[model samples]
Target: MFASSLAVVLLTLAALLGAIVAFAWAWRKGHFHVDARAATLPFDDHDQRVARPWETPSQARERVQAHGPPLPPGPGEWGGA
Candidate 1:
């Protein structure tokens, strides 16, 4: 029982130390620095204007005001069978 408990404690400490080391390494490598454009890499112009069905008229107007007119999705784009 004592041996198992000590093993658990040691394993936990090792895992914590590993996490700290990885975080420090990432910080030093500039991995934590992010550019604004990087956040939009996954989206294109069409994605920015696509209409959302769940939005109310006011919300839709707000979206249009912010992002121009919303484009309707192409046929089958809504995942119907």
Candidate 2:
């Protein structure tokens, strides 16, 4: 049991050290750099998608009748007020 516990602790420490080294290497290599081009990746020409408009009151009522009332807003959603 002592050997096994020591092995577990050593493995965990090694994994954490490896992660830190990798992060430092990436930082030196500018892997963490952010640019406007990277920010627009999701909006590239190949992936031009738009959100549909919100449901009207009548549509919302129909949805309630067909599929039960919509779920209440989850945590942090205040419905803009």
For lDDT, the strongest prediction is 1
| Pairs of residues clashing in candidate 2 | none
Clashing pairs in 1: none
Residue 38 of model 2 has an lDDT of: 77
- Measured on C-alpha atoms, candidate 2 has an lDDT of 0.63
Instruction: At residue 8, give the lDDT of candidate 2.
Output: 91
The digit string of per-residue lDDT tens for model 2 on 1-81 reads 466988999999999999999999998999898675778665533222222136677876775665554665444443454
> What is each predicted model's overall lDDT from 0 to 1?
0.86, 0.63
Q: What is the per-residue lDDT of model 1 for residues 1-81, given as tens digits with 9 covering 90 to 100?
A: 467988999999999999999999998999997777899898877877888788899988997897898999777655895
Q: Against the true structure, what is every candidate's RMSD?
A: 3.9, 13.9
